[model samples]
Target: MTYLLICCRLLLGVVFLVAVTGKLRGPAAFTAFVSSVRRMRVLPAALARPAATAVVAAEATIVAAAAVPVHAAGVLAFATAAALLTALTAGIVTSLARGGQEPCRCFGTADTPLGARHVARNAALAAVAGTGLLAGLLAAPTGAGPLAAPVDPALAAVAAAGGAVAGALIVMLDDIVALARPHR
Candidate 1:
């Protein structure tokens, strides 16, 4: 349970941090993200900028919350991440239903248009977040301090490494898929 919580926390933190950095890397990158939001048509064009800003803010918050070692904070962070992923999945589904082929600038500017793969990826992430939240709740310590039980240093390091690798793979999913696809 300790290792699971640690892995989940680091996985979510790394994912959110990479996402935030990709979007905010530069004015052009951010502009592209805003444009992608507008193209989704889930929200009115007037709200695109605000929506984009809110998304970035939420991702940033998740990263910060996950970084905290407190048991309560981990629970809250996982819950927030799950909610965010659910919302994102809904948006992607809605866009696809409307026959929108807008590029998903999810991890920065990319030409890959949104598709079922994006939905699947988001759903998987949401499930991971849900699992983490459940684990955190179930493993809550009885003491006043909500800190988790100390894990063996070696095991903790392994968990962190595994989480980081998973996060990186997720972040690069699009690129990996593109590379694997046979060129016309």
Candidate 2:
């Protein structure tokens, strides 16, 4: 269960970090992407850029908070992860309901098309965060409780690297598959 928490934390942190980085790497591009989604009339036309900027900032903050010690950072990371998953789920549902097939800006320009994959990943992450929250609540009480447990040095290093790789791979999975398939 502990390992599961760690894995989930790392994965969420990595995803947020990468997403922020991608958006920040090209703020204008992200804004354009947001505009593209908005063009579908999902979001109010006036709120598009501001909303996109806010999401970028939120992702940045979540990534930073998620990187700290478990006792302090873990709880916040769990909350952030849950929030992100919820947002993504909402976006997925809205897009499906609107009968649009716009590309998800989650992975920025590097991502392929948007579809069930975004929803699926968000669902899995939300489950992980929910489990972590439940486990934390069930544990014994203390001033610190246990959100900021000292991360194992070796484990932390591995988790960081693995998280980055996994996130990148997940984001690129569709592109890779498309490239692999033989032309009709």
Candidate 3:
């Protein structure tokens, strides 16, 4: 369970870090993201910029909270991550139902339009966050200190490596699917 928690924490942290970086990469990138938000039509046109900014801030917060070694912080971070992903998923679903074809700005300037795959991705990530939250809560000890118990070095290394690989795969999922499709 400890190793599982470690893997989940690292995975969420890496994913959110990549996501936040993608949006904050430059003025042009963020502007594009705001444009994508408006195109999604998830909120009023006037609120697009603010919504985009809030999304990026939330991602950054998840990353920061995941980095904290405290048990309670881990639990809170996972909870926040789950909630954010759920909201994003709902937005995607709404956009799809409205027949919006705007490209997803999720992990930077990807030309992949919103689709079922995007919904599945967000759902899967939310599940991971939920699982991490459960693990953290279940592992808590009565009167535990601020910091979590130290994990075995080898286990920690393995968990971190696994999480990194998973994060990379998720970030590249659209490209992976594109490559797998039959070229006309």
Candidate 4:
């Protein structure tokens, strides 16, 4: 159970942080992505920019808040993830119903367009968030007692850097893979 919570924390943290980084790095690209989806009628033109900005900002905020002590942070992280999942699920369902096909920028950019698979992935994350929230409520502690202690400062720094790198890679893997594909 404790291990599961830790996994959720790491996965959600890395995922959101990476997402925010990709979006932040390519704001124009993301805007273009959002606008393209809007044109496809997945989102309204009037709501595109604001919605895009809000989603990115919310992700950033979640990752940032989740970095702190577990009590409040866990709650915040859960809420943020739930909100994201709800939005993504609704968008995916609506688009599918309309026979719309648009890329999901949830992970920033992707080789494939948004579809039921992406929605399922988000739904899984939502489940993780729910589990974490429940765990936090039941167990007043963030991580297991001693094993979770901070490591040496240097090692901690290295780990943080690695997490960031891995997060970025994970978020961009689809786009990177797409670029590697042979042009038809």
Candidate 5:
């Protein structure tokens, strides 16, 4: 169970790190993200820049907090993740409901257009965060997850590989869904 929590932390941390890096990779990417936010219409055009900054800052904080192996940090990371995911889901829903057609600049560029899959992905991420928080809260004193020192190298390696795979799948969801669609 401790190892599971650590893996969750790793997976969640990697997800945020990737998002932050992809979104901020260059001026063009950031500009694309701002444009997507404006298309969503969740916030006023005047507020898009500050909102983008806030979003990136929040993601960075989640990555940093997730890297800490303390029980409290895990809880904080999960809580923040869940909240962030909820807001993202809402934005997606709003865009879809309003018939806004634009690519989701979620992982990187706006190559992949927004769809129900994006909403599903966000919901899945929120679920992961909720589960992580519950695990932290249920953990015993002195901690058993990442806080339980002396993690085996082999175990850690396996966990890391798993986290990497999970993160890859999430970031590639657009492609995955596209591939799964039936062709004429």
Candidate 6:
């Protein structure tokens, strides 16, 4: 269970870090993300860029919190992750309800158009975060409580690496889908 919790934390951290890095790849990349946010049509045009920046900043914070092995930080990070995923899911739902066709600026470079997949992905992430939050609270504990059985350091390290690799593969979903599509 300890190793599993570490795996989940690392997996989610890597995913969010990759997402932020992709969007911040260049000015054009960020502008495209902002444009995608605008296309969501959830906010006034004047607020789109600011909203995008805020979202990116929030994701960066999540990466930092989730990646660093700060004591008791995992609990907070999981909660934050859950909230972020929920908000993202809401945005996707709103876009879908409005019949939006904008590409999900999810991985920055992936041109995967918004669809049911986005909602499913976000919902899945939120569930992971929720579960992690519960598990982390018990495993890591707050101040002055009995700790769970310690995890083997070597095994934990391996799990961490595996989690990161899993995240990278998940981000490549678009490319994988593209390759599988029949050529025009």
CA lDDT scores, all candidates in order = 0.89, 0.68, 0.90, 0.69, 0.84, 0.81
Model 1: which ten-residue window has the lowest total lDDT?
Answer: 142-151
Alpha-carbon deviation at 41 in model 5, angstroms: 1.1
Cα RMSD (angstroms) for every candidate in the order listed: 1.5, 3.1, 1.5, 4.7, 2.2, 2.6
Cα lDDT of model 2 by residue, 1-184, tens digit:
4444566567767778777777767767687568756754567878777777777777777777767644546667777677867876886778777886776677667445566766787787688678766665554234452444444668756766776677667656667778888999
Give me candidate 3's TM-score against the actual structure.
0.95
User: What TM-score fits each model?
Assistant: 0.95, 0.79, 0.95, 0.73, 0.89, 0.89
Residue pairs with backbone atoms closer than 3 Å in model 4 (clashes): none
Q: What's the residue-level lDDT of 135 in candidate 1?
A: 93
Q: Whose lDDT is higher: candidate 4's or candidate 5's?
A: 5
Candidate 4: where is the Cα deviation over 4 Å? 40-42, 141-184
Positional deviation of residue 155's Cα in model 3 after best superposition, in angstroms: 0.7
Tens-digit lDDT track of model 1 for 1-184: 9898888888888889998999999999999999999989999999999989989998998898999888888888899999899988999999999999999888887888999999999998898899999998899775554354756889989998998889889889999998999999
Error of 5 at 102 (Å): 1.7
| Candidate 2 clash figure, as a count | 7
In candidate 3 the C-alpha lDDT for residue 6 amounts to: 79
* Candidate 2 stretches greater than 4 Å from native: 139-164, 179-182
Candidate 4 displacement at residue 20 in angstroms: 1.2
64-85 in candidate 3: lDDT tens per residue? 9989878888898899999999
Q: For model 6, what is the alpha-carbon lDDT of residue 152? A: 73
